[model samples]
Target: MNLLFLGDVVGRAGRDAVLAHLPELRRRLATDFVVVNGENAAGGFGITEKIARDFFDAGVDCITTGNHVWDQKELVGAIDRETRILRPLNFPEGTPGRGAAVFQAPRGRRVLVANVMGRLFMDPLDDPFAAVGHVLRQVRLGAGAGAGNGVDAVIVDVHAEATSEKMAMGHFCDGRASLVVGTHSHVPTADLQILPGGTAYQSDAGMCGDYDSVIGMKKEVSIARFVRKLPTERMTPAENEATVCGVFVRTDDRTGLGVRAEPVRIGGRLAPHLPEA
Candidate 1:
């Protein structure tokens, strides 16, 4: 159980480079649990509760979102009391927050993230593989009777915009998830694998901000709305120095899956990965 998913943090140079390198990346990847993707973290779109309490005081235990998760508008009523802020589990059923939960890490285990949101070219909610197979049939991962009382890990972000629906929701949560990353296309995709039904896929874990613009916005106003097709302003972000993309697994405490999976660029313009802990 080592998990760490990041991707999608756009504004303010991707939230000051993930609050300045996520506490040395959770002490050089010995991380016990940490999910990010604050739906473009405030200026590129949504997410705001004082920036989700400054990403939970920079330790980030959970916070996922997609479809701009309500572009800030008071987080649609403060995300129904912020249960660690998650949105897009096929919204529409009183959609406010929650797309999935189950936190508690550091030894007592039990992870279960799950944010989900991929309806082809976007915004067609529901049926994100039947809402992630009804929460993977109420969690079950590995520990005893078919992984005992379940949940020891099981990330599953998938906030896609079609990379074939984020590699078909990472082979449909293969092996019942342990990673299955991907976020609203900010670029970073080199296919960090582990699949073969043991989860830990990648498809895209890109955008933490400033990839020299145009995915993190601000490339000459996204190139004049694609060479003057119309609307020219309104696309901020990309305030320079930012390059925090993510994904990093390491599960299997008792069959919880993902034995290991890397890809986690750091600092500015890409070209740096941190795995071996």
Candidate 2:
């Protein structure tokens, strides 16, 4: 299955960009499944129900969250009702939404989607390594231990603050998961490769927000906050230009191995790298 995974959607700018460009992208890429990080979809904080639904309507198969998952109180209840949205598996038990889910993609194939957050430089949470291991075992067992059992692929979203942590996680899940991509650090990393064990890996998928400013934040506001160290008001989305940044991976159905992985950057100031026809 061909899968597209978008990075953090910062605010209005990011959402607008995705809505405007994703349709064409999906068609051109022939993506069978799409996952977008919506943690900051609502004004660079947390995703709201409306925003999450908008992403769903715009061709995203599942929505993933990171440290900002609960910034908006309404999401706690809204997400529980929807299995398409996923929070980190390592979140303390009793957290409102689910950490993972299995959804049928195109061709009636099952794809297991799991989200886990790295603990290093992040909020205190359960061990991601353990959480992910448990989920992988369940999928493997359910698939009849390599029978493939109508299970086409497994995707892992490692939302992390550090590149080292993300890379480590990718290596840890190399052969067990089909694709292990990272998010949360708005800046995209240069590396995008299929590991020796066949899992696709990217240190960071970048942000699906305004590219003209600093990490999707208004330039002046962020500058002021950091330079002065004063409690300045939060930054808002830029109204004009925006971009969508992410990683796209194609995995084999029978073997659940990644065939191709590439970084995608669109609109705003970034140069276009359209998918090959």
Candidate 3:
């Protein structure tokens, strides 16, 4: 099975890029399941139900979020019903929405998707390592006690701020999960590799917005906010010259081992990896 994981979608440009390219990319890659990080999809804040629906309509199977998952107040209720949208698993217990779920791919394959938030350089949360264990157990067991879902593979999106912490998780979940991809940094790392244990790992999958801007934010506004150290208005997304960044991983259907991992950057200022067919 092939899983295509996209990083944070910034704003209009990010949305348009996905709408314009995802279908073709999926076709070329023969993706079975696609997950996109949408924490910043709506104006670089929490995702709204409408935006989430847009992403779903655009062929995204599941949407994962990070610290900004609650940016949109409306999602408080929408998340309760939207099983496809997942917040960080490490959030305190009783949080709205789910942290993990088993979803069926087009081939009738049961695939597990879990999201967790790291603690280093991020808002303090429950231990992600422990939370991952809890979610994994649930995925292995299914809904009822030991009833079992026979899930063919598991994918984890570790939304984190620190590279060291993210790399640690990749090793920690090496054998148990098919893919342990990182997010929240918004910059794609160059260390894409299949771990010794068969798990695919990447420190950061990068953002699906303007690469010329500061982490998808308006360049001048972000620079002023940083250098001036004042309450400058948040930078908005640039409308022109968009790019989409992510990682494409193929895994063994039965054993859930990663067979290949590759970084993808298309359009905008980033170098293109996709070639003419």
Q: How does model 1 score by TM-score?
A: 0.35
**How does candidate 3 fare on TM-score?**
0.94
Candidate 2, 1-277: lDDT as tens digits: 7889999998988999999999988999998889999999998899998898888898999999989999998988888898899999999889888998888777667788899998888888999999998888776622422355436788899999888989999999898888898998888888999999899999888888888788888888889988999998867866567778988888776677788888888998787666573
Clashing residue pairs in candidate 2 are none
Model 3 per-residue lDDT tens digits across residues 1-277: 8888999899989988987889988889888989999999898888999988888888999999999999899998899899999999988979899898888887557778999999998999999999888777655421222236566678899999999999999999887888899999999999999999999999999999988888888889988987999988756887777889998888876577788888888888888886222
RMSD of each: 15.8, 2.0, 2.7
Candidate 2 has what TM-score?
0.95
TM agreement with the true structure for every prediction:
0.35, 0.95, 0.94
Sort all candidates by TM-score, best to worst: 2, 3, 1
Per-residue lDDT of 63-148 in model 1, one digit per residue for the tens?
Answer: 99899888779888988888988897888887667899887787677888888888887777778888888898987887533345
lDDT of 2: 0.86
Root mean square deviation (Cα) for candidate 3: 2.7
Worst 10 residues of 1 by lDDT: 142-151
For model 2, the stretches where C-alpha displacement exceeds 4 angstroms are 141-150
How much is the lDDT of residue 39 in candidate 1? Answer: 84
